[model samples]
Target chain A: MKKVLFLFVVLFGSCAKLDNNLYNNDNKIKEYKLDDYTGEQDFILDDSYHIPPGLVTLLTLPSQADGESSSTEIKAIYIGDVSKINSDTVLLYCHGNKDHMDFYWQRAKLLAHVNGKNKYGVLMMDYRGYGLSKGKPGEKGMYADVSACMQWLKNNGLNNNRLIIYGFSMGTASACELSANAAPMLPDKIILEAPFASVAVMIQDASQLNMPADYFTDLKIDNAEEIKKCDQPLLWLHGKSDNFLNYKTHGQAVYKNYHGRYKESILIEGADHGQVPSQMGFENYLKLIGSFIRKP
Target chain B: MRLIRFICIFLFLIFICFCSPTQLVKPLQKGQRAAAITYGGPLIKFAGAPIPIPFTTLGFSYGLTSKITGYASLHTTSLIFGNLQTTVGGLFSLYEQENKFGLTVSPAIQTAYNIRNKTGFRIWPTLDLNAYYHPLQKPSFVYIGANSWFELSSLRAHNEPQANHIIPNIHAGYMLVKTKWQHQFEIKYLGLGIPNLPGVVDYIGISHKGALGIYYSLIRKF
Candidate 1:
């Protein structure tokens, strides 16, 4: 009797049909509007209460992959000393699922200020449906947006040797996908923060049960599977106390699967989810990141 | 004692199979029929009191009249090991106006079973009320409703259990087909409890219903 009851509870709890009503509304996509702020005056500090010093420039990258009629726009922030663009290494930062690029502006600034004498450029962009970007955000739309920004960087004379990719949470999947399909030019290094093993694994972890991976979102980008194909140096950072994305299940899986030249894993003791870098103090975290990048 | 246990088991099985508030109503016409079903589990939270328990239910319904309909549903809850409670009831629609407005009333009876004492039976009485609206030209609609239940049996812990609750259901969907067939999705907050566990406590509950079923007439013609 106990066994039967346990089975019943598990069956119902694990696979409750997704509440389609929450997403059925047609108003999921809204036009992006810039928040009122002084021109480049520590916007991140104002928005998220984090103070990092750098020259922040707002840029828009147009997406033409969806044909001439497509009006999709990609909103991005370029952070660094604008005068030293020709010699500085560029970091393309991709944020997690919840908010827009503005949420990570402070982090980008810290990345730029890591090696003070040696300048670095950091560019963070909003996926479609987030912030000032156009249209609803989905798997295909996000890939197009990132590709457009990469092309924009290439056109402006930034090449593989001077380019680094940093992705967090959902953006880690995008970073891995791009790295696997890199053109003749590839990124110098890839950093994943709070990365997941794969889409199927994430869904199963969230549901707390076994669900058929095939029935999930039609576009499946398995980062764990894709990371094996890339030879780039990979860095993964995760917090041990993260309850939302279990460290052992998602983060550990990626670390175990990456068969690359150089792979580094940092497990913060008390950090939770997106709080690792911030909790460690910006300067100390920046120093660690700088040493990792400049290591021979 | 053995005979009494057999009779109780047979009656309980009959209640599980037949008695319910949301059930399919046979249509009067031949082409298509429209019906609605509603079922809820036991209250997990009661104001400052929180109880860790398992409560669940399943309801299926079919349409009978073009504007007027009928339904039946079943509710089951497990308060403790070896003691499972169940409620069975049926409902009828008084009137409906071309999906514009509707009024319905339901009556039900509930029973409890003790696995240790298979011969015991306890029954109770329940009532429910509903009102629904859908504009002819607009893509928006609303439904306001309520329900009550009263225990009729003389069990130590089961006497005169009364509940008064309300439901406000709203829907917005493009008419994929004319009145006969339309793809519809609805968001409803069925407020099922009073100030102190009066109905069913549902502050953190939200229901989203979407269906791709066809709507046809039975008795009443346009």
Candidate 2:
């Protein structure tokens, strides 16, 4: 018994000292400093675009895990009137995995414009390890960052009845994370743009093989599987020619498999991954989104 | 939900191991050879539900010298279309006592390929320390062992992190004695470890909980 105990200790003790890099493969997350070149004041809209005035920058919001506060604080932007947030509809726009808010400035401006030119509010934030947020980006960390932002909006009198959630590209994972699982509060509706089913499905699509789940990162943000549990109104928009994430395998899969009360999808022909809104025409895009929001 | 999916996969891998035949616990004499076929699966519990998946394997061992043996095996899931793993190993006896107990150490390397469509490959290096006790009868004996493996290769290209590298397994079982037959049933377990590298835990997001398995085997000696 003593020998067995000693052996167990030796074996388990050695594992704790093993290198950390051995387990992670192809985790190509690029963390960058916040782009100070662009600011709230710099977002001047052209005649084609509509800009909202409040455009306030949220300095830092705390991320909590298991009820303990994480050291990382997130940065975000609110592109609407703070006073109108209580009365008007608000859209929390979760952006894709890229540089930061600067990369998504146009999308936020467009979403605000989509919301009847500042009649509604648009909120956007950088997940931890993305922009000015501290700490590395974990699945839970990003979830916590988004949750903090949602909590902040709720604290400011933005309720679920007037809140819409929109996700684009990698941000779909964060959006699905909130919806498939229970949050502090649910959204009135969900909008997914060029969403992938899951990381495994995406890899399989990329590699063109029936790879198993947990094949790569175990980052099981399986939107296809998770969406079945969400019972909210959903709006899906995708380009027919999206090369990065195939519309049929990802977007259509999620939409087709969604067991929601109300759901709709729009597939624009000849539009690629990043050019859906452009190809669909801004006026038409606004009309579709506006109808979804104003629906009884 | 993510946690449930992670647990399901982790447990499935253990089920695959559970279906595999036991490695040669007793060192073979010169000119002796043993071949076996195994079948088993895991009883998995997740989200208050139980799931069992079938697994199978074919294994063989040959004695090169009085105290050394070479072994190899092929294993798959559901008889087809999930994953296929091939393993090669050598065992050298360090100590032996007739009608009593013996000790041996084995070092093995294994490579697994997914067979569904595209080929995904991973490699693991394993070391086993085993002890066998023979009270009076030679073939009807009991054994205990532990195997530790470090993942040396991944399915993804370009140094992306994979989940759980140091796989530690423990086993114990009794052998059913027969002249030309090697039959055994064993209990096995693979314990989970913490993610030591940056980006590993974030990507894998699996808790450090181990899996328990039940295994059985039948072999022919020549």
Candidate 2 per-residue lDDT, tens place, B1-222, comes to 433444344333334433444778877888899988876555465556544444567888999897899999876442233345677998999898876888999988776665443356656677888899986856589999988776543532212234444567688988887899978887766443432111111112125234455677898889
Per-residue lDDT of model 1, residues B9-33, tens digit only: 2222222212222222212233334
Error of 2 at A231 (Å): 1.7
What digit string (tens of lDDT, one per residue) describes model 1 on residues A156-259? 77878788888887788778888888543478888888887765554433222232233323346677778878788888888887644667767777777788
Candidate 2 Cα outliers beyond 4 Å, as residue runs: A1-47, A50-53, A67-71, B1-222
lDDT per residue as tens, model 2, A143-236: 8888888888888888888888899877887787798787766888899998988766554433222334443343557787778888879999
Per-residue error at B212 for model 2, in Å?
42
TM-score of 1: 0.52
Give the residue spans of candidate 1 off by over 4 A.
A1-54, A65-71, A81-83, A183-185, B1-222
Candidate 1, which CAPRI tier? Answer: incorrect
Estimate candidate 1's alpha-carbon lDDT, on a 0 to 1 scale: 0.52
